[model samples]
Target chain A: MADAPETFEEFRKSFSYGERSDLDFKFMKSLSDDEAAQFLAGLLAHVGDAYDHARLTDIIDYVIDWQARAYAPAPDAKRTWVYEEGPFATPAKPLADSRVALLTSSGHFVHDDDPEPFGVVGMTQQEAEERISEFLKVPPELSRVPVSFAPGELRVRHGGYDVTSAALDHNVAFPLDHLHDLQADGVIGELHDEAFSFMGAAAQMRLQKETAPEWAKMLRDAEVDVVLLVPV
Target chain B: MCHVSVGHVGRAIEEAGIATTAVYVRAFGHVVDEMKLPRVLITNHPMGRPLGPVGDRQRQRAVVASALSLIDSATEPTVVDDLGPFRPVGG
Candidate 1:
């Protein structure tokens, strides 16, 4: 077994904020002075050994779960379009039909696009959905959100039994369904027929590029107008 | 879709000349002074998931499109707009 964390603070530090700090900074910028203070207060309140591993995990998980629901898309806000240069560009003319495709990979099934390639892991759609649901349960509001699986080209090998079972399960790290739902509600106006997904983390970009053409083709076949890529 | 820090990815995308909008959930009705982007949306939702609940296809599309539309409609360098709530069905 590994050495126990030196202290509660040490264990907390092990939670690994790394790039997540960047995410937090962005989140802070979006807040008002008072709101920011409240957020910081919440974070401060949970510090120290007041909670154990399971409890801390639950707290962190609850924070993430709360944030997802709190950040769920609003309907009245105006939407904007972003078109990447090179291959993916918004056409000069709007698409006649606004069909969009949703794409995502089973969590833990890391692909080339993932920044941290933990490798592949076998998981059924049902298992992935259940895992995602459990993840959302910490924050009750998110329980209402649904999960959908759209066929796509990205694939990876199962990490196998030696790997921790948790490692093989889909983490659903991002709020993908929320993004897709926004698209379908006419809030996004138009969506490409096919959406794309891969394992979460930093290393998956390579796989994403290689697989992009195939996804593009899928969108083309579906006569999709705008491809909305969601990070899950 | 992809929840990124505004300062980190938002500016990078905008600096690249690609139109970009940052959506702030939970900070709704709150004014942000440091935002330098072309368009931004503020709502009362949480972070990580800018668009509401996962798997709600209809709601996701609407949020994405609304963010995209700001690019064409925004008149100022930094426009701050509010999306009241995530009422996907009737509202």
Candidate 2:
């Protein structure tokens, strides 16, 4: 009935919780940083010892997603592009006889070459952890990994989803470990020495035009029979 | 474009005359279906955690097993195998 409150403090007095009107935002603009930090910290503790911020962020994302799914169903996305009919290729050998390669669009990379504009490889372990912690908390800045990537060099840089769990165990996205498992059990014959992580979501048209061909050549050069592409 | 790139990359490798199978979620699976690559496997997993849920070893292994199998079983370009949704641990 009265004119709208002009100042934020005046507006707060006019607001009520759980109002189903235009001003019904559940989160408050004036929320304190300590409050938010503590809240997220508690959530992080639930997923890990609280030291591993990456895993905590990932678990929190999945948990929040789980809760949201229980509340409402997401609508199907519309397709914008109609692809032309493309090539069809099949495996030439049996599972036990074929060599496999791993490819993922999860924005993961080996941190060796250059942590880049945000590089942290040469930093102390604690310093690297601190930098990576900042990386996960902030918006993602992805890098192109160079040759000579090893298992311990794994880093998750995807902005589309939580990198926490993937940070703790890089295999969740890349699954190079599982590839080895398959080879050990003879489910697959062997793994190529190289695998790749794409900093996807953005730079996509570039991927289609240039990067995809390079990836194809890489896989082809590996003598890979089945290229297992795991898209995030 | 994040999702459709999967099909693009798959198409690229397929063009190389090598077998390629895409593992992805529903909406993107629709794109993969529309694009119609060499082999496709649909799974109901989260966006970033495509192989399976985070910290889930056995589930990841299950997903990998089924996805790789599609490489062998897909007789045509249109074949799409769905692995359904992620079942939370102990659910």
Candidate 3:
């Protein structure tokens, strides 16, 4: 424990894969340089000196599994079909002059709006699961969050991943404030007056078939030149 | 939270004549490629913090700026841009 590796290079040497796949090693290498630093700092700081190869591998395995489940499509969802003409759209204007909008999948809504995001909140674990199972059978609605809304004026309602980070600062997931900053800097012509959000872990089949066209039409009607999609 | 759903939504938006650039975790690069999304920016940050760490305004701003830039540069469908490692304001 006291001899836990201090660097990723050192850490890499602690394990050997004579007959096993190196999938886990590749996953660890995918961490950005700064993320790697944060990963090591947090591991060394909180894990203290009791780290071992098995323990570290267990952490990696858990993360891999969690992410796999989080991003997998709902069972009821079938493969998505792309637009025949293709989905590429050239910006009609430069970013610095284009009206940019943000559309997030963070399941956020204005405090007073009281949107029901799959109605999973406050229910027991079993109840929530049942609610989500039924909810995923269709496309969910979207909430329009004002770009200038205050902190306490917003609320989050999502089932995937812990919402604490976004709860502390909605910008972590939505980034509306930063978009506003970019607009102020003239990096973008304008921040669309409203940003949109919705629960993302739902039926993609229904989303593409029904809800998505409506979202597209609305943004198109607003003359939005470019949209940034942020998925929680 | 759901990169696949986001990709589908982005596709719909693009089909409606609105340019779209989606931010996705690098871990899901395979899905983005498989789906052939119009435009995408890859970030190595964790799932919940797609832009960056909480309250780290500098990094978040960088991510947003990059996404906007991608809108201007991408000339074809399925264009993916790697934001590379995040370098803080003055790390």
Q: DockQ of candidates 1 onward, in order?
A: 0.13, 0.42, 0.55
Q: Clash totals for all models, in order?
A: 68, 3, 1
- Clashes in model 2: which pairs? A54-A164, A115-A119, A116-A119
Worst 10 residues of 1 chain B by lDDT: B1-10
DockQ pick, better of 1 and 3: 3
lDDT per residue (tens digit) for residues A1-232 in model 1? 9987475333223322222223323334334456556655776666544454323543444355345433433445453322332111333333223443343321322233332322224444333322432322221110111234332323332111111212222222223444455555545545443334443322223223333344345445555543332332
The per-prediction i-RMS, to one decimal, reads: 10.5, 4.9, 4.1
Query: On residues B22-50, what C-alpha lDDT tens digit does candidate 1 reach at each position?
Result: 45554322222233434555544333344
Q: Which stretches of candidate 2 lie over 4 Å from their true place?
A: A1-80, A114-151, B78-85
Root mean square deviation (Cα) for candidate 1: 12.7
lDDT of each: 0.37, 0.61, 0.70
Question: For model 2, what is the alpha-carbon lDDT of residue A222?
Answer: 71
Better of 2 and 3 by lDDT: 3
User: What TM-score against the true fold does each predicted structure earn?
Assistant: 0.39, 0.65, 0.73
lDDT of 2 by residue, B4-26 (tens): 66667788888887887777765
Q: List chain B TM-scores, each candidate.
A: 0.64, 0.81, 0.82
